[model samples]
Target: MAMIEDAGRRRALRTLTAGALAAGGGLLSVRAFAGGLATVNMQLGWVPGGNQVGEVVAKRLGYYEKEGIDFHIQPGGPNIDGVAIVASGRFQTGEISSSPSIMLAVSEGLPIKCIAVGLQQHPYTFFSLKKAPIRSPQDMIGKRIGIQSTGMVLLRALLAKHKIPENQVKIVPIGADMMPLVAGQVDAVTGWQTNTTALKPLGADRVDLRLWDTGVRLYALPYYATTSMLKEHPETVQGFLRATARGWMYANQNRDQAIDMLVKDYPNLNRADERVAIDSLMHYAFDQTTQTQGWGAMDAAVWEEQIAMYGQLGQFRAAQPKVDDVMTLDVLKATHSSRLKV
Candidate 1:
């Protein structure tokens, strides 16, 4: 990989690597981490939970072991810079929370490419109460839209997609809390529709305006690897994809057992909550496209659409990255039969 020009980013990644080694019980390696199995430390964009049920199932069921792989999931929090970590070669691969992240990273000259999409349709939604419903982009007009500073881009994309003037909607900067929306502080709040834990406060009367429905299509839970890793070890990357596909397929087919395995892996996760949340999670994971194309499926047209939208919104600092720079079909193509098994 070319040298990463940003010094602070490199330092942050170095610190993260050291800390991950210490906190992870020891240093880990891909080819020679443990018993000669190819190791893949998957750095998550958030703390482990129901989103990782498939991986947890895979590990517990020895699916990775069957593929001669030692997969480790490293947790990421608000402080963790997962993209930097993956770009710095600290980890073999990483999974970000959303697809836009990959595009933004590539625009900044990050040497990473999305290998597969975990969720075909992004779960990001504009949540509102039933009383003052903002069911569509038109409803956003004159409404105080509560969103995090980080999510401003999403709101902008929604507006740009529908040609809604930015001044029409009031952008209310707020944390990820439903209280603001509940107390009539704002008309709506932005969050992942699958985040049932966080959505508990909104009550059943909540109205959801999904980002995808607003024409700002995006992918969530996208897996990516450094460009160097893809070129150096294509077979290893293919192996990881194959095993991961099997894990997800198993989780889709056997939901109860998957949740059972998930709770076992992470004792902190409540079984009841995960059980209820799995249905919503599965809905995003397997849709019509998944029924025909199988799991971990994605369409290039969608990626191109996101790129064009973000580019038009001036979200890309450097020159806009090509579709190939943002993602690759090789890994997905290599594991076609296994991923297609459904």
Candidate 2:
């Protein structure tokens, strides 16, 4: 009976040993199964805007290396379209503006998902001079405003919601220096808070009406990934997010240096103006909505409602995307910051 019991124990031990070997071999196979290349690549929308800073720093500072990521940055423009590049399986991941990415992805049947939002709110902000006596968006009725493009849909939504007739305002194309408003070419400019930073030196103060008030309550742009990538290589996406969370934190606290680094990569453009853009970008990057949740927290209701507004303006042809349809909140799991809300 004793001998029989010992044999049974040996058989169980052998089985355990075989299982351990199989598990160890399976792990090695998974590691070897990683997508080839020592680096993971991503495309970015702009060349040197505040939007691309975290990715830029992650590359320059070797944080991506620590995360085992290889970045292939394909810098385009505020105007250059990368939706196809991101959606067609050419690149594993990239960033388009969050709102537009969501809207476009839903409209065109793309498989992209917004995994992380870098800022708390939209970065597009309006600025009037400190001495202009204009306190809010409602105060600007019938005033001439300089604008970057008339194609902007959110401005239209604000106008529609505020009951301001489209014809009541005069619109003009402007530059980063607030040249139109400065030269009395217009009442105020709808340029970014960063582009108008130079206005302070030119005898004007600025207000981040988005933060200071409740006019354009849009969400911040986000980093993105494909559905296939999320399913196939979740670890890569998670690593990228971990590196990116640190990158945004770095960009937010290290403003001037981030700008300086940006200028190093993007020279000959206006540096001072770019700094304001960067600072404002960071300001909008971290906001109350984002603060309450994780760094990339988003409400599907807010996004769908905004998309519906765009659809009303003829920007889209489809029904508003379901909140879960366009955006997902899973990547925030990559952050170890217990302070992260959502």
Candidate 3:
């Protein structure tokens, strides 16, 4: 979904201007409804599905309402520029599929800053059959790697980190299908490990080489807001994080019930697929770090590492972004006690 479309989406983000963002000020303020619940709309860069399970669970269970938030999700597609929309203040907050979108946007002078990350480690991985296993970055050499056009940069970063020359591997640009790999057109294909349904055809012979394990560290499903929103409405942001963290924790502990609520909220999602997907999703969401720091916790060092890696790759089109420009921990700090730990 979002991982496949980011290359073009980053280009769309660069088109946002100060004048256009200023025009959206009329809808910037957090609107309070008749019951004094503030409206908080979360704009996304991809269509809602398994990735939004926590939010769906929260909304269906009244967690947002308990936090005094009238939360709503604004769906995004290929034609929509979710980052620009949030930067322009049309939506109070936004959650993009990958962390680089936020860094790249901020470097281009967008006023948004990441407040919390939903997944501590990105689930993007290189998948190969056991017969020709690509278990590590070095194993990718001399192989045909099937990747989406937008994910070429990720492959570049992985190669760069491991000091492998780009020419060593054959890069095959393909659509979001695993058929190329299965048909021997490519040795491996790239996709999120949490996408169980898509990975079904690959079967038990599938081998995963995750992007995070390759030293190309990145966050997924990052929650962000404009600088003004973080400054003017910190409490609202904290409340949202608290409720969301609780929702994820609940989903982790009560799997079947969470998927039931999720499908009920969005009838289009198949319960069986989401139920299978959440297990993989939770593994990335909670780990040794989240056990102590709690859900949504992030380290400045990780942000700095991501910035340095992306900068070295020459991904930034404008001024290089500093760590502070990309993310802030105030909201996470405020909601620490409220978040559940594993």
Top candidate on TM-score is 3
How are the candidates ranked when ordered by lDDT, highest leading? Answer: 3, 1, 2
lDDT of each: 0.85, 0.61, 0.87
Better of 2 and 3 by lDDT: 3
Per-residue CA lDDT of model 3 for 31-79, tens digit only, reads 6563799999999999988888888888888899998999999998877
What is the Cα-based TM-score of model 3?
A: 0.93
Model 1 weakest 10-residue run by lDDT = 1-10
Q: What is candidate 1's TM-score against the reference?
A: 0.92
Per-candidate TM equals 0.92, 0.75, 0.93
Model 3 residue 128 lDDT?
A: 98
lDDT of 2 by residue, 1-342 (tens): 001012332344345446646666331111342344345557676664656777766677777667777766777675445555555555567776546655555565566787877666565666666666446667667777676553345567777777888788766666556667667677776644444455564453554455224444556556777777777778878777777666666777787877777667767556777766776676666777556664566666666676666666666544556667777777665454632521
lDDT tens readout by residue for model 1, 101-205: 898888877789999999989999999999999899999999999998778888888887888999999999999878899889999998988888889988899
Candidate with top lDDT is 3
Q: How accurate is candidate 2 locally (lDDT)?
A: 0.61
